[model samples]
Target: MSSLTVAYAVAFYVAAAVLVLGLVVKIKQYATTPSPLKIPTMPAPRTRLGVVLRILREVIYFESLFKSNKWIWICAVLFHAGLWLVLARHLRYFIEPVWFWVVLVQPFGIYAGFAMIAGLVALWARRIVVNRVRYISGPSDHLMLALLVGIGFSGMMLRFVERTDIIAVKAFFLGLLRFDLQPLPAEMPLLVHLGLVITLMIVFPFSKLLHVPGVFFSPSRAQVDDAREKRHLAPWAAKLDAERDSAAAE
Candidate 1:
Protein backbone atom coordinates (compact mmCIF):
# COMPACT_ATOMS: atom_id res chain seq x y z
CA MET A 1 0.00 0.00 0.00
CA SER A 2 1.15 3.55 -0.72
CA SER A 3 2.04 5.77 2.25
CA LEU A 4 -1.09 7.82 1.54
CA THR A 5 -3.32 4.76 1.93
CA VAL A 6 -1.51 3.71 5.10
CA ALA A 7 -1.86 7.21 6.52
CA TYR A 8 -5.56 7.33 5.71
CA ALA A 9 -6.12 3.95 7.28
CA VAL A 10 -4.43 5.10 10.48
CA ALA A 11 -6.41 8.30 10.48
CA PHE A 12 -9.69 6.45 10.08
CA TYR A 13 -8.87 4.12 12.95
CA VAL A 14 -7.92 7.01 15.20
CA ALA A 15 -11.00 9.03 14.28
CA ALA A 16 -13.31 6.08 14.92
CA ALA A 17 -11.70 5.52 18.30
CA VAL A 18 -12.08 9.18 19.26
CA LEU A 19 -15.68 9.32 18.15
CA VAL A 20 -16.75 6.17 19.97
CA LEU A 21 -14.82 6.86 23.17
CA GLY A 22 -15.97 10.45 23.32
CA LEU A 23 -19.62 9.48 22.93
CA VAL A 24 -19.32 6.83 25.63
CA VAL A 25 -17.73 9.25 28.08
CA LYS A 26 -20.27 11.97 27.37
CA ILE A 27 -23.17 9.54 27.68
CA LYS A 28 -21.88 8.28 31.02
CA GLN A 29 -21.76 11.84 32.30
CA TYR A 30 -25.29 12.45 31.12
CA ALA A 31 -26.46 9.28 32.86
CA THR A 32 -24.77 9.99 36.22
CA THR A 33 -25.57 13.71 36.48
CA PRO A 34 -28.50 14.09 38.86
CA SER A 35 -31.72 15.77 37.86
CA PRO A 36 -32.65 17.52 41.12
CA LEU A 37 -36.25 18.46 40.41
CA LYS A 38 -39.53 17.42 38.86
CA ILE A 39 -39.16 19.95 36.10
CA PRO A 40 -40.89 18.40 33.12
CA THR A 41 -41.94 20.90 30.49
CA MET A 42 -45.54 21.99 30.96
CA PRO A 43 -48.10 19.89 29.07
CA ALA A 44 -45.66 17.01 29.30
CA PRO A 45 -46.39 13.33 29.51
CA ARG A 46 -48.07 12.02 32.66
CA THR A 47 -46.84 8.43 32.32
CA ARG A 48 -43.60 6.65 31.47
CA LEU A 49 -45.11 5.20 28.30
CA GLY A 50 -46.33 8.64 27.30
CA VAL A 51 -42.88 10.08 27.91
CA VAL A 52 -41.32 7.44 25.67
CA LEU A 53 -43.81 8.21 22.91
CA ARG A 54 -43.22 11.92 23.26
CA ILE A 55 -39.48 11.49 22.95
CA LEU A 56 -39.99 9.35 19.88
CA ARG A 57 -42.10 12.05 18.34
CA GLU A 58 -39.52 14.66 19.12
CA VAL A 59 -36.66 12.60 17.58
CA ILE A 60 -38.44 11.27 14.52
CA TYR A 61 -40.49 14.34 13.63
CA PHE A 62 -38.68 17.15 15.44
CA GLU A 63 -41.99 17.92 17.12
CA SER A 64 -40.87 21.07 18.96
CA LEU A 65 -39.05 22.45 15.94
CA PHE A 66 -42.01 21.74 13.69
CA LYS A 67 -44.29 23.62 16.04
CA SER A 68 -41.88 26.56 16.38
CA ASN A 69 -40.59 26.91 12.80
CA LYS A 70 -41.93 24.93 9.88
CA TRP A 71 -39.22 26.06 7.45
CA ILE A 72 -36.32 24.97 9.64
CA TRP A 73 -38.05 21.71 10.35
CA ILE A 74 -38.45 21.07 6.63
CA CYS A 75 -34.72 21.54 6.09
CA ALA A 76 -33.90 19.30 9.06
CA VAL A 77 -36.19 16.59 7.76
CA LEU A 78 -34.61 16.64 4.33
CA PHE A 79 -31.08 16.51 5.71
CA HIS A 80 -31.69 13.80 8.29
CA ALA A 81 -33.77 11.63 5.98
CA GLY A 82 -31.30 11.91 3.11
CA LEU A 83 -28.30 11.34 5.33
CA TRP A 84 -29.85 8.13 6.67
CA LEU A 85 -30.45 6.78 3.18
CA VAL A 86 -26.91 7.62 2.14
CA LEU A 87 -25.49 5.87 5.21
CA ALA A 88 -27.56 2.80 4.53
CA ARG A 89 -26.28 2.70 0.98
CA HIS A 90 -22.71 2.94 2.23
CA LEU A 91 -23.06 -0.46 3.90
CA ARG A 92 -22.14 -1.95 0.56
CA TYR A 93 -18.54 -0.88 1.03
CA PHE A 94 -18.20 -2.40 4.50
CA ILE A 95 -20.17 -5.59 4.18
CA GLU A 96 -18.66 -8.59 2.39
CA PRO A 97 -21.98 -9.66 0.97
CA VAL A 98 -24.01 -6.52 0.71
CA TRP A 99 -27.55 -6.79 2.03
CA PHE A 100 -30.45 -6.73 -0.40
CA TRP A 101 -31.85 -3.58 1.15
CA VAL A 102 -28.53 -1.78 0.68
CA VAL A 103 -28.46 -2.81 -2.94
CA LEU A 104 -31.96 -1.45 -3.38
CA VAL A 105 -30.96 1.84 -1.77
CA GLN A 106 -27.92 2.51 -3.99
CA PRO A 107 -29.84 4.36 -6.70
CA PHE A 108 -31.87 6.39 -4.21
CA GLY A 109 -28.83 7.25 -2.10
CA ILE A 110 -27.35 9.01 -5.13
CA TYR A 111 -30.35 11.33 -5.31
CA ALA A 112 -30.51 11.70 -1.51
CA GLY A 113 -27.04 13.22 -1.71
CA PHE A 114 -28.55 16.23 -3.46
CA ALA A 115 -31.30 16.58 -0.87
CA MET A 116 -28.72 16.49 1.91
CA ILE A 117 -26.74 19.36 0.35
CA ALA A 118 -29.88 21.34 -0.49
CA GLY A 119 -31.00 21.14 3.13
CA LEU A 120 -27.52 22.06 4.36
CA VAL A 121 -27.39 25.13 2.10
CA ALA A 122 -30.79 26.30 3.29
CA LEU A 123 -29.79 25.84 6.93
CA TRP A 124 -26.48 27.69 6.47
CA ALA A 125 -28.33 30.52 4.73
CA ARG A 126 -30.74 30.72 7.64
CA ARG A 127 -27.83 31.23 10.00
CA ILE A 128 -26.59 34.07 7.80
CA VAL A 129 -29.87 35.52 6.52
CA VAL A 130 -32.04 35.65 9.63
CA ASN A 131 -31.29 38.50 12.04
CA ARG A 132 -32.16 36.73 15.29
CA VAL A 133 -30.53 33.46 14.19
CA ARG A 134 -27.44 35.19 12.87
CA TYR A 135 -27.15 37.14 16.14
CA ILE A 136 -27.11 33.94 18.15
CA SER A 137 -25.11 31.84 15.68
CA GLY A 138 -21.57 31.14 16.68
CA PRO A 139 -18.61 30.42 14.39
CA SER A 140 -18.69 26.70 15.20
CA ASP A 141 -22.26 26.42 13.90
CA HIS A 142 -21.29 27.74 10.47
CA LEU A 143 -18.15 25.62 10.38
CA MET A 144 -20.08 22.44 11.06
CA LEU A 145 -22.53 23.22 8.25
CA ALA A 146 -19.67 23.92 5.87
CA LEU A 147 -18.02 20.65 6.75
CA LEU A 148 -21.24 18.73 6.10
CA VAL A 149 -21.80 20.55 2.79
CA GLY A 150 -18.27 19.85 1.62
CA ILE A 151 -18.77 16.19 2.39
CA GLY A 152 -22.01 16.03 0.44
CA PHE A 153 -20.74 18.04 -2.53
CA SER A 154 -17.50 16.12 -2.88
CA GLY A 155 -19.40 12.84 -2.59
CA MET A 156 -21.71 13.91 -5.42
CA MET A 157 -18.73 14.94 -7.47
CA LEU A 158 -17.22 11.48 -7.03
CA ARG A 159 -20.43 10.05 -8.44
CA PHE A 160 -20.95 12.54 -11.31
CA VAL A 161 -17.67 14.33 -12.07
CA GLU A 162 -14.34 12.70 -11.34
CA ARG A 163 -15.18 9.04 -11.25
CA THR A 164 -12.80 6.87 -9.24
CA ASP A 165 -12.46 3.11 -8.94
CA ILE A 166 -15.25 2.31 -6.47
CA ILE A 167 -14.16 -1.32 -6.38
CA ALA A 168 -10.80 -0.24 -4.96
CA VAL A 169 -12.69 1.98 -2.50
CA LYS A 170 -14.68 -0.99 -1.25
CA ALA A 171 -11.51 -3.06 -1.04
CA PHE A 172 -9.80 -0.41 1.04
CA PHE A 173 -12.59 -0.30 3.62
CA LEU A 174 -12.99 -4.07 3.68
CA GLY A 175 -9.27 -4.54 4.16
CA LEU A 176 -9.39 -2.12 7.07
CA LEU A 177 -12.00 -4.33 8.67
CA ARG A 178 -9.89 -7.44 8.08
CA PHE A 179 -6.77 -5.92 9.62
CA ASP A 180 -5.05 -5.77 6.24
CA LEU A 181 -4.36 -2.45 4.57
CA GLN A 182 -5.45 -2.08 0.95
CA PRO A 183 -4.58 0.48 -1.73
CA LEU A 184 -6.98 3.45 -1.58
CA PRO A 185 -7.91 5.41 -4.65
CA ALA A 186 -5.96 8.64 -4.22
CA GLU A 187 -8.49 10.77 -6.06
CA MET A 188 -8.96 14.41 -5.04
CA PRO A 189 -12.73 14.26 -4.55
CA LEU A 190 -12.49 11.06 -2.51
CA LEU A 191 -9.71 12.52 -0.39
CA VAL A 192 -11.61 15.73 0.37
CA HIS A 193 -14.87 13.96 1.14
CA LEU A 194 -13.20 11.43 3.41
CA GLY A 195 -11.08 14.04 5.18
CA LEU A 196 -14.17 16.09 6.00
CA VAL A 197 -16.01 12.98 7.18
CA ILE A 198 -13.10 12.08 9.47
CA THR A 199 -13.03 15.61 10.83
CA LEU A 200 -16.75 15.48 11.52
CA MET A 201 -16.43 12.19 13.36
CA ILE A 202 -13.58 13.47 15.48
CA VAL A 203 -15.42 16.67 16.45
CA PHE A 204 -18.94 15.27 16.72
CA PRO A 205 -18.89 14.41 20.43
CA PHE A 206 -17.79 17.89 21.50
CA SER A 207 -19.98 19.70 18.99
CA LYS A 208 -23.68 20.57 18.71
CA LEU A 209 -24.07 17.13 17.17
CA LEU A 210 -24.29 15.81 20.74
CA HIS A 211 -27.89 16.86 20.52
CA VAL A 212 -28.46 13.52 18.79
CA PRO A 213 -27.93 11.55 21.99
CA GLY A 214 -28.42 14.41 24.43
CA VAL A 215 -32.04 14.83 23.38
CA PHE A 216 -32.93 11.48 24.94
CA PHE A 217 -31.47 12.53 28.28
CA SER A 218 -33.04 15.98 28.47
CA PRO A 219 -35.01 16.49 31.73
CA SER A 220 -38.00 18.25 30.22
CA ARG A 221 -38.40 15.57 27.58
CA ALA A 222 -37.51 12.41 29.53
CA GLN A 223 -39.30 13.05 32.82
CA VAL A 224 -42.91 12.00 33.35
CA ASP A 225 -45.32 14.61 34.72
CA ASP A 226 -46.11 12.82 37.96
CA ALA A 227 -45.06 15.44 40.50
CA ARG A 228 -48.66 16.09 41.55
CA GLU A 229 -49.30 12.39 42.15
CA LYS A 230 -45.92 11.49 43.68
CA ARG A 231 -43.10 13.44 45.24
CA HIS A 232 -39.95 13.77 43.19
CA LEU A 233 -36.45 13.56 44.66
CA ALA A 234 -32.98 13.19 43.18
CA PRO A 235 -30.67 10.45 44.50
CA TRP A 236 -28.55 12.90 46.44
CA ALA A 237 -31.56 14.64 47.89
CA ALA A 238 -33.08 11.35 48.96
CA LYS A 239 -29.82 10.34 50.61
CA LEU A 240 -29.70 13.63 52.49
CA ASP A 241 -33.25 13.13 53.71
CA ALA A 242 -32.41 9.65 54.94
CA GLU A 243 -29.34 10.91 56.82
CA ARG A 244 -31.41 13.67 58.40
CA ASP A 245 -34.01 11.18 59.62
CA SER A 246 -31.28 8.92 61.10
CA ALA A 247 -29.65 11.81 62.95
CA ALA A 248 -33.01 13.03 64.33
CA ALA A 249 -33.78 9.50 65.61
CA GLU A 250 -30.32 9.16 67.23
Candidate 2:
Protein backbone atom coordinates (compact mmCIF):
# COMPACT_ATOMS: atom_id res chain seq x y z
CA MET A 1 0.00 0.00 0.00
CA SER A 2 1.22 3.47 -0.74
CA SER A 3 1.97 5.84 2.18
CA LEU A 4 -0.88 8.00 0.91
CA THR A 5 -3.33 5.14 1.33
CA VAL A 6 -2.28 4.43 4.89
CA ALA A 7 -2.29 8.12 5.83
CA TYR A 8 -5.70 8.72 4.29
CA ALA A 9 -7.13 5.61 5.93
CA VAL A 10 -5.97 6.84 9.30
CA ALA A 11 -7.25 10.31 8.56
CA PHE A 12 -10.66 8.91 7.63
CA TYR A 13 -10.88 6.97 10.87
CA VAL A 14 -10.02 10.02 12.96
CA ALA A 15 -12.32 12.33 11.06
CA ALA A 16 -15.24 9.91 11.29
CA ALA A 17 -14.73 9.51 15.02
CA VAL A 18 -14.57 13.25 15.56
CA LEU A 19 -17.61 13.86 13.38
CA VAL A 20 -19.78 11.26 15.08
CA LEU A 21 -18.76 11.85 18.65
CA GLY A 22 -18.71 15.62 18.41
CA LEU A 23 -22.22 15.66 16.95
CA VAL A 24 -23.49 13.36 19.64
CA VAL A 25 -22.06 15.58 22.34
CA LYS A 26 -23.28 18.83 20.85
CA ILE A 27 -26.75 17.47 20.10
CA LYS A 28 -27.03 16.19 23.63
CA GLN A 29 -26.21 19.67 24.87
CA TYR A 30 -28.84 21.15 22.63
CA ALA A 31 -31.47 18.69 23.77
CA THR A 32 -30.74 19.08 27.46
CA THR A 33 -30.57 22.85 27.49
CA PRO A 34 -33.67 24.03 29.33
CA SER A 35 -36.16 26.55 27.96
CA PRO A 36 -37.81 28.05 31.01
CA LEU A 37 -40.15 30.27 29.02
CA LYS A 38 -42.56 29.93 26.15
CA ILE A 39 -40.88 32.02 23.49
CA PRO A 40 -42.18 30.63 20.23
CA THR A 41 -42.18 33.09 17.37
CA MET A 42 -45.46 34.68 16.35
CA PRO A 43 -47.84 32.70 14.13
CA ALA A 44 -46.30 29.58 15.70
CA PRO A 45 -48.20 26.34 15.89
CA ARG A 46 -50.38 25.67 18.94
CA THR A 47 -50.23 21.87 18.84
CA ARG A 48 -47.29 19.48 19.00
CA LEU A 49 -48.12 17.95 15.62
CA GLY A 50 -48.46 21.38 14.06
CA VAL A 51 -45.08 22.35 15.50
CA VAL A 52 -43.52 19.23 13.96
CA LEU A 53 -45.01 19.95 10.54
CA ARG A 54 -43.92 23.56 10.76
CA ILE A 55 -40.37 22.47 11.57
CA LEU A 56 -40.50 20.04 8.67
CA ARG A 57 -41.55 22.81 6.31
CA GLU A 58 -38.86 25.10 7.66
CA VAL A 59 -36.18 22.47 7.22
CA ILE A 60 -37.20 21.18 3.82
CA TYR A 61 -38.16 24.50 2.22
CA PHE A 62 -36.41 27.13 4.32
CA GLU A 63 -39.83 28.70 4.69
CA SER A 64 -38.73 31.56 6.94
CA LEU A 65 -35.80 32.43 4.68
CA PHE A 66 -38.12 32.49 1.70
CA LYS A 67 -40.36 34.97 3.50
CA SER A 68 -37.36 37.08 4.59
CA ASN A 69 -35.08 37.17 1.51
CA LYS A 70 -35.67 35.69 -1.92
CA TRP A 71 -32.07 35.76 -3.15
CA ILE A 72 -30.55 34.04 -0.13
CA TRP A 73 -33.37 31.51 -0.14
CA ILE A 74 -32.76 30.65 -3.77
CA CYS A 75 -29.05 30.15 -3.22
CA ALA A 76 -29.66 28.08 -0.10
CA VAL A 77 -32.14 25.81 -1.84
CA LEU A 78 -29.85 25.31 -4.84
CA PHE A 79 -26.89 24.40 -2.64
CA HIS A 80 -28.84 22.20 -0.25
CA ALA A 81 -30.81 20.37 -2.91
CA GLY A 82 -27.70 19.69 -4.95
CA LEU A 83 -25.84 18.58 -1.86
CA TRP A 84 -28.52 16.01 -1.03
CA LEU A 85 -28.42 14.60 -4.57
CA VAL A 86 -24.62 14.45 -4.60
CA LEU A 87 -24.63 12.66 -1.26
CA ALA A 88 -27.13 10.12 -2.52
CA ARG A 89 -25.02 9.52 -5.60
CA HIS A 90 -21.92 9.01 -3.46
CA LEU A 91 -23.52 5.96 -1.81
CA ARG A 92 -22.28 3.90 -4.75
CA TYR A 93 -18.78 4.25 -3.40
CA PHE A 94 -19.75 3.10 0.11
CA ILE A 95 -22.30 0.39 -0.62
CA GLU A 96 -21.30 -2.96 -2.09
CA PRO A 97 -24.38 -3.14 -4.30
CA VAL A 98 -25.52 0.35 -4.99
CA TRP A 99 -29.21 1.07 -4.47
CA PHE A 100 -31.36 1.52 -7.57
CA TRP A 101 -32.11 5.09 -6.57
CA VAL A 102 -28.42 5.86 -6.27
CA VAL A 103 -27.70 4.41 -9.70
CA LEU A 104 -30.55 6.46 -11.11
CA VAL A 105 -29.17 9.61 -9.52
CA GLN A 106 -25.66 9.25 -10.92
CA PRO A 107 -26.39 11.24 -14.08
CA PHE A 108 -27.91 14.21 -12.32
CA GLY A 109 -25.16 14.26 -9.68
CA ILE A 110 -22.75 15.82 -12.16
CA TYR A 111 -25.08 18.66 -12.99
CA ALA A 112 -25.94 19.06 -9.31
CA GLY A 113 -22.26 19.60 -8.65
CA PHE A 114 -22.39 22.67 -10.87
CA ALA A 115 -25.44 24.00 -9.04
CA MET A 116 -23.74 23.39 -5.73
CA ILE A 117 -20.71 25.39 -6.84
CA ALA A 118 -22.84 28.17 -8.23
CA GLY A 119 -24.91 28.48 -5.04
CA LEU A 120 -21.80 28.54 -2.92
CA VAL A 121 -20.25 31.22 -5.12
CA ALA A 122 -23.32 33.41 -4.91
CA LEU A 123 -23.57 33.03 -1.12
CA TRP A 124 -19.90 33.84 -0.68
CA ALA A 125 -20.19 36.85 -2.96
CA ARG A 126 -23.07 38.13 -0.86
CA ARG A 127 -20.83 38.11 2.18
CA ILE A 128 -18.23 40.09 0.24
CA VAL A 129 -20.42 42.54 -1.64
CA VAL A 130 -23.53 43.25 0.41
CA ASN A 131 -22.88 46.07 2.85
CA ARG A 132 -24.89 44.59 5.76
CA VAL A 133 -23.64 41.03 5.24
CA ARG A 134 -20.08 42.16 4.59
CA TYR A 135 -20.03 44.25 7.74
CA ILE A 136 -20.82 41.29 10.04
CA SER A 137 -18.88 38.66 8.05
CA GLY A 138 -16.10 37.06 10.00
CA PRO A 139 -12.97 35.23 8.92
CA SER A 140 -14.41 31.85 9.87
CA ASP A 141 -17.46 32.34 7.64
CA HIS A 142 -15.27 33.17 4.67
CA LEU A 143 -12.92 30.31 5.48
CA MET A 144 -15.81 27.81 5.55
CA LEU A 145 -17.11 29.01 2.19
CA ALA A 146 -13.62 28.84 0.65
CA LEU A 147 -13.13 25.31 1.95
CA LEU A 148 -16.45 24.11 0.51
CA VAL A 149 -15.71 25.77 -2.85
CA GLY A 150 -12.30 24.13 -2.90
CA ILE A 151 -13.80 20.71 -2.19
CA GLY A 152 -16.43 21.10 -4.91
CA PHE A 153 -13.96 22.50 -7.46
CA SER A 154 -11.38 19.80 -6.83
CA GLY A 155 -14.05 17.11 -7.06
CA MET A 156 -15.15 18.48 -10.46
CA MET A 157 -11.53 18.47 -11.63
CA LEU A 158 -11.15 14.84 -10.61
CA ARG A 159 -14.32 13.97 -12.48
CA PHE A 160 -13.58 15.97 -15.64
CA VAL A 161 -9.98 17.15 -15.89
CA GLU A 162 -7.59 14.82 -14.06
CA ARG A 163 -9.33 11.48 -14.34
CA THR A 164 -8.13 8.90 -11.84
CA ASP A 165 -8.96 5.24 -11.29
CA ILE A 166 -12.42 5.56 -9.82
CA ILE A 167 -12.70 1.81 -9.36
CA ALA A 168 -9.71 1.95 -7.04
CA VAL A 169 -11.23 4.96 -5.31
CA LYS A 170 -14.47 3.11 -4.53
CA ALA A 171 -12.53 0.04 -3.44
CA PHE A 172 -10.45 2.15 -1.06
CA PHE A 173 -13.54 3.51 0.73
CA LEU A 174 -15.18 0.09 0.80
CA GLY A 175 -12.02 -1.40 2.30
CA LEU A 176 -12.11 1.17 5.03
CA LEU A 177 -15.52 -0.20 6.05
CA ARG A 178 -14.37 -3.86 5.83
CA PHE A 179 -11.12 -3.27 7.75
CA ASP A 180 -9.11 -4.11 4.65
CA LEU A 181 -6.80 -1.44 3.27
CA GLN A 182 -7.15 -0.95 -0.49
CA PRO A 183 -4.69 1.00 -2.61
CA LEU A 184 -5.77 4.64 -2.84
CA PRO A 185 -4.86 6.47 -6.03
CA ALA A 186 -2.35 9.15 -5.19
CA GLU A 187 -3.39 11.45 -8.02
CA MET A 188 -2.87 15.03 -6.83
CA PRO A 189 -6.47 16.10 -7.51
CA LEU A 190 -7.83 13.02 -5.80
CA LEU A 191 -5.63 13.61 -2.79
CA VAL A 192 -6.59 17.27 -2.58
CA HIS A 193 -10.29 16.44 -2.84
CA LEU A 194 -10.06 13.77 -0.16
CA GLY A 195 -8.02 16.05 2.09
CA LEU A 196 -10.61 18.82 1.92
CA VAL A 197 -13.40 16.32 2.59
CA ILE A 198 -11.64 15.00 5.66
CA THR A 199 -11.06 18.51 6.98
CA LEU A 200 -14.72 19.40 6.48
CA MET A 201 -15.90 16.30 8.33
CA ILE A 202 -13.57 16.97 11.24
CA VAL A 203 -14.57 20.62 11.63
CA PHE A 204 -18.26 20.12 10.92
CA PRO A 205 -19.36 19.44 14.49
CA PHE A 206 -17.75 22.62 15.83
CA SER A 207 -18.58 24.94 12.97
CA LYS A 208 -21.62 27.08 12.12
CA LEU A 209 -22.50 24.26 9.74
CA LEU A 210 -23.81 22.57 12.88
CA HIS A 211 -26.96 24.62 12.28
CA VAL A 212 -27.95 21.54 10.28
CA PRO A 213 -28.82 19.71 13.52
CA GLY A 214 -29.15 22.71 15.78
CA VAL A 215 -32.18 23.87 13.85
CA PHE A 216 -34.21 20.95 15.10
CA PHE A 217 -33.52 21.96 18.67
CA SER A 218 -34.17 25.66 18.25
CA PRO A 219 -36.47 26.83 21.07
CA SER A 220 -38.32 29.37 18.94
CA ARG A 221 -39.29 26.78 16.36
CA ALA A 222 -39.71 23.77 18.61
CA GLN A 223 -41.80 25.44 21.28
CA VAL A 224 -45.59 25.39 21.05
CA ASP A 225 -47.64 28.57 21.29
CA ASP A 226 -49.96 27.52 24.09
CA ALA A 227 -48.52 29.54 26.93
CA ARG A 228 -51.87 31.18 27.71
CA GLU A 229 -53.62 27.85 28.01
CA LYS A 230 -50.80 25.90 29.66
CA ARG A 231 -48.01 26.77 32.02
CA HIS A 232 -44.45 26.14 30.87
CA LEU A 233 -41.85 25.23 33.45
CA ALA A 234 -38.39 23.83 32.98
CA PRO A 235 -37.51 20.59 34.76
CA TRP A 236 -35.47 22.22 37.48
CA ALA A 237 -38.10 24.84 38.07
CA ALA A 238 -40.84 22.22 38.33
CA LYS A 239 -38.80 20.23 40.83
CA LEU A 240 -38.31 23.34 42.96
CA ASP A 241 -42.03 24.08 42.80
CA ALA A 242 -42.85 20.54 43.92
CA GLU A 243 -40.58 20.95 46.96
CA ARG A 244 -42.23 24.23 47.84
CA ASP A 245 -45.72 22.66 47.70
CA SER A 246 -44.62 19.77 49.94
CA ALA A 247 -43.11 22.17 52.51
CA ALA A 248 -46.26 24.30 52.64
CA ALA A 249 -48.48 21.20 53.07
CA GLU A 250 -46.25 19.95 55.97
Estimate every model's Cα lDDT from 0 to 1. 0.93, 0.94
Off by over 4 Å in 1: 243-250
Candidate 1 lDDT tens digits, 1-250:
6999999999999999999999999999999999999888989988999999999999999999999999999999999989999999889999989999999999999889899999999999999999999999998999999999999999999989999899999999999999899999988899998899999999999999999989999999999999879888887889899999999999
TM-score between model 1 and native: 0.95
| Prediction 2 TM-score vs. true | 0.95
lDDT value, residue 170 of candidate 2: 99
Put down candidate 2 lDDT per residue, 142-166, tens digits, no spaces.
Answer: 9999999999999899889999999
Query: TM-score for all predictions?
Result: 0.95, 0.95
**Cα error, candidate 2, residue 142 (Å):** 0.6
Compute the lDDT for candidate 2: 0.94
Count of backbone clashes, every candidate in sequence: 0, 0
Candidate 1 root-mean-square deviation in Å: 1.6
Q: In order, what is each prediction's RMSD in angstroms?
A: 1.6, 1.7
> Which ranges in model 2 have alpha carbons more than 4 Å from their true place?
239-250
